[model samples]
Target: MNSAVTSRTLARTDSVRPFKAGAYGFVLLGIGHLALSAAAATATQTSERRAVDTVMRESTFALLGLERTVLDVFNGMSIAMAFFSITCGLLILAAVRHAPALVQRRTAFGWCALAVSLAVLVVSVLLLPPPPIVVLTVTSCAFGLSLRRATTVSAHAAEAA
Candidate 1:
């Protein structure tokens, strides 16, 4: 690309600052979650964890007419959540790169992300340990900052117009 185009691209990328933080937070946390979940699932279990694993593996419940062990259900949920978090991050990155103007204008995408992040943060606080809780806290905060910045820019543009 020409220098002019390259410069414009770099400038555009630079403009949406806080969105980057939130997007990377979601992406990185999802990766960490996936890695930790897989490691914990596979790592040599301690006595207590082994006992719980046995119960989880042995215990069965019917859902949608299918029987599933607690272990199976829990693992499935963990994988699903990892994918969802990664997708949310990718979507935000796409929005930031491909539709910066729309992002600044304040869209449903931003609102949904903020809401989902906060909801996850709350759940993490209640159920998970410090690491996930801290990640969610930062993710939610970055999302909130990005959205608030977008709202301010939109308001200023409106006033100027």
Candidate 2:
């Protein structure tokens, strides 16, 4: 009898096309985040140094090695945030694939991960310059909304019977 109910639940879940699409979307977003992050880590350091050089060219503290200090500090933070973003994306992808029940119950986890990614990107706009704002924002918001809808459907299904 329990097995029958479980089968019924799975059948109902199968009809949720959005959930499947959202899972795929999360996977793609995760891959994009990882790839872009790697690109930034490898190629952008010189650009970042150039920007710092431009900004500090007129400042007196150029004599105190302030430009190099700023570059080091901000570069370290940017690298750390990039790694964190990639890890969060990967976690979302993994959870959607291997742990749907956990995803449903702890929907906040997914939301928080997306939110953090958005927040970091938004900050990067000012500090790092020309980060992929639109892609990250849209993908994060869409994935978060889809995950929320999935959990809601699951809840409604449970309450209906």
Candidate 3:
């Protein structure tokens, strides 16, 4: 899941599409990301990862006057990323509950989501594997389709009004 979408895709607009997409899709993805990270952290390491961990532990680097190993930095970064994703997801969900008057108007909410998801999709495709790439692709399409439908509905409303 893209942190940018979890953090920035939701706007204060009155759009249920935002709520449904963010709550159903993005929030679930965030939780899944955190769960997967926790699982990986606890699962027995593969030989490749174990070897890397050994080498990483052997080397020490100074950061802020404290000595840290590569493994320390790597683990810290991974945990932080997972924490950030779940945090954003929970926050968005909270917003959905507390803010009930979010189904009357529309804004660029989906555009923001689509943009960030697309960018993340590209990066995932280039650097990561298929799982993340597929997630991003699905998210991008959701946002785009939601945005299109929202616009079409609102446009008809404008005509009727």
lDDT of 1: 0.79
Higher-scoring candidate on TM-score, 1 or 2: 1
Candidate 3 structure quality by residue, lDDT tens digits, 6-125: 455554333555545643555555666678878888999999988988999999999789999998998887667656656655665565466533323335444555677788779878
Give the top-scoring candidate (lDDT): 1
- After superposition, candidate 2 runs with Cα above 4 Å error: 1-51, 54-68, 104-106, 124-131, 153-161
Name the weakest run of 10 consecutive residues (lDDT summed) in model 1.
Answer: 6-15
**What is the TM-score of candidate 2?**
0.51
The TM-scores of all predictions, comma-separated, are 0.81, 0.51, 0.66
lDDT of 2: 0.54
Per-residue accuracy of model 2 over 120-139 as CA lDDT, tens digit each: 55765665544356555555
Off by over 4 Å in 1: 1-15, 152-161
User: Which runs of model 3 end up more than 4 angstroms from their true locations?
Assistant: 1-15, 94-106, 152-161
Judge candidate 1 at residue 72 and give its lDDT: 93
Report how far off residue 157 is in candidate 2 (Å): 7.3
